[model samples]
Target: MKLEDASSGSLGPVIEVIQSILNQTGYILPALVLFIIALAIKYPNRLPGTTDPKHRPGVYFPPGADPLIGHTRMIVGFGSEGQFENFKALSDATPAGSWNVSFLGTSSMTFVNRPEYLEYIQKTNFDNFPKGSQFTGRLGDLLGVTGIFVADGHPWKTQRKQASHMFSNREFNTWVRAVIHNELDDISALLDNVTAKNGPGKLILPELMFRYTLSSFAKMAFAANLNCLSPDPDSLKRPVPFAVAFDRAQAIINDRFITPGWYIWEKFNKTGRDMRSSIKTIREFGLDIIHKRLAERQDEKKDPLAPVEGTKKEQLKKEGKDLLDFFMDLTTDPEELLIVVLNFIIAGRDTTAQSLSWLFYELMAHPEHVPKIRKEIAEKFGEPEGGVRLDYESFRELPYTVACLHEAIRLHPAVPKNGKAVMKDDVIIPQGPNPDNLPPVRVFAGERVGWSDWVMARTPAIWGADCEEYNPSRFLETDEAGKLHLRNFGQWKSHYFNAGPRLCLGMNLATYEATAFIAAVLPRFNFEWATAAQGQKSAWPPQYANSVTHPIKDPYLVNVTRVKA
Candidate 1:
């Protein structure tokens, strides 16, 4: 008899026997459970056909992957502190440059560590490997389907085209410059006030950087002035509602990535409720700004030459327009407007703040490099005594400052890993040593392919033996005469800003802002890591919290004193 027919025929008798045994002694049930637990513990990845050494015809999966669950348990076991450790393990396991594994026993994931494969996925076959629905669906609740980050296909292309136009505008660059200068001035004043009140003030740099970037983006992109740097009692008491909501929404959205299925969270869970609430708060904030901007734009259209009677246009030229105004000209859909605005804010704010925080941490750790950066800035922009106003042209001259920012980001990239889902059956040719002379790995449709900037940036094969060290000088090359010169390693090799069609539109703006801020701050303040006592050793490599962007885990406390030049 066939197994199915035999099982069906014996079901009633088997149930009767089990029930009779259970009725007789409940202790047997516990013993059976213990036996199963022992078996699982002894052979975690021993599921049938998973550990076979034989290579499959299409793709090669590493030997240790569990047949169903994949590496989920191992990843979760590491927690936040050991997250990078787990990624390192995966990277080491994929000696042939790529490997396939099942996630949650439902979806197939192919991780690619080679730059050649990254080029293939992001550029050569970009259309074939779009950010598929699964990736978008995970972030849809928070980001919606309208923005470039989560958008795919025609919608993504349209958004990218529109954003590219706006970013390239000369007027937009001027507006960005004005916003950065103003925010940096505010930060300077705040620091001065702290120093005046208490000699050598201690500061949590990450928090301050976040506020600075948030306020800067708010003023430049949206016409809202969120006084995030204000020191007044009233301002301190009343926090920016939208800022809080946006942060909470991001946290909740990131949680979804590690969570299992949609039904588990969406059907009956507090996480779903919290997500909806956070999105509502964020949407409401974006809509309010959109409507306000729309009205202002309508007024301008009625009388183009008549300057708006306020400080709103202070940062913009008579003919200049903010991003929202640009979007208003394109589409009047509020949802679309909100998505675009939020997307820009997130891209601008989080990445810049995190990058700055990491830069400062590196500066504190390696104080010897500080004077070199300061000397370069002072030579170009004069001393930051009265305060330095960095414009588009002047900002480019401080190449050392820019190199420091790049080095920091290389070490601690904001968006460490980026994923793209395969829309068709695509084959990736291995670029590394194929000991088995393995053929091209055939990736199936619906499988997710990704590249980890965190892993790739630190790989010895790509960046050499000293890749783990924080040396900005690596970005600089010595000529035959032994004079050092800066090298522009473009986004393709860097991978921090990503590459191909989806390259970060705000790359220029982010680089300029970071460079300018460093120029402005370094000349005015004597920075050092805060110590428990004057004679004690300061904390060197700060503990960091792992996320899409790796931020310093705790407040990066630093002692700041006004420099006497």
Candidate 2:
């Protein structure tokens, strides 16, 4: 089925769920009444010097910020690319490579683009910068309050420790590789069928990638074959409803971050109502999955044929344990299980899927790299017909292919923007001596600080003058053997997977899956821009949706053909 059909199967129950959420706003009414009173006091700036905006020292307050509305107009009005341009302009305006803007005169937000400031908040003083209440509050309803993504302090540590097992274990790595290989085989078959039936299909790449990654992750995480990549359209409907609702909920929640006093306006807006309904559907589906897994575990325990106690890990190695099995060992509470599982899905699926979609875009833009990538794959795994799959160790040897993937993300990071809240007053210091005359910027408690990897990715100082160019060679270096090797551009320079204590838990798994996918498909299929009708430009320099992740605004239409080899 097409991506649009994900929510098509059944909506009668969803509408009922929406009405149920709308009807149960008992406390929301009182909050709305208080908000009205607050608005009366807040809207008309009564303080002295309120007619003109007041600027703070060491802060670049760009034009168009009204004293009454602040930057709310741009935040709400601008598209994703426009917003990126605004931040890029701000980064260029200051030597410190960061800027601040007020919101509704009540709160201020700082946008950090420099590597020094990024390290300061994400790594150096990580404890002081947690995903505080403001950030978590925006996401609490969708991603549960206690999930690893929303949690801070001890709760986050506990979940992180438990989840770390999957990445650290060698056996689990091998198991994950086999699962990815299996998924890629299925994708190849589906594409092969399409090519046989028709000459070349105009594929929406992001949709296809998302489905492939979702199905792959579902198997590794829950041992459930969602078959979201099924050729049979009817079989695809079962999981599409939950997938659609999940995607909608994430996009809406991300908007809450920039919308000033969002909680106040959300109650009365259509966006807010849609968010509530989406959350209801998401939670219902998640709870059902959790409960069914729990029941299966109970049945496993009673089976006399189950693995003996001491050999359980070995048995899991052979049978391939899902992430849910690990979490079940940690907690029996259904709510907690649901939160972690959903968080796992977001981490394991969305980021990598988006990254690969953009990778293909990069490949299309620079088709010369296609032969290079395919040659490297052939050297390592023979040819597509040979059916040789890269395991955990062998996948690491394809340095050039991995470099292309790295460079693609360097330009278009999946999680392009991330931030942390200040716990107390602090001064942000640049890493090097004050060469640019960049002064230290003081930040107070209760303020938010964010960094845009998108801007940093294109910064002239960080990546030289040709930073905008798509060149995979930048991520490689010649070693003693005279062969190209992947450069280790540490966390600060390569901050896509994040850094410090809150680093991405699924980084290794994501890398393995993406590289393996490139290996699998490049040898068998070719991609290029889909032909456009007269007067159209084929959506060059792709536009992105203003969502939680960097999703292509429209369908990423591409021409897919089979290789003659």
- Report the number of clashing residue pairs per model: 0, 0
TM-score of each: 0.85, 0.85
Residue pairs with clashing backbones, model 2? none
Candidate 2: residue 396 lDDT (0-100): 74
lDDT of predicted model 1 = 0.72
lDDT of 1 at 337: 85
lDDT of 1 at 524: 86
Please give the distance, in angstroms, between residue 219's alpha carbon in candidate 2 and its true position after superposition: 2.1
Candidate 1 — worst ten consecutive residues by lDDT sum?
47-56
Candidate 1: clashing pairs of residues: none
In angstroms, give how far residue 329 of model 2 lies from its true place.
1.6
Best candidate (score: lDDT): 2
lDDT of each: 0.72, 0.74
Q: Cα lDDT for residue 372, model 1?
A: 94
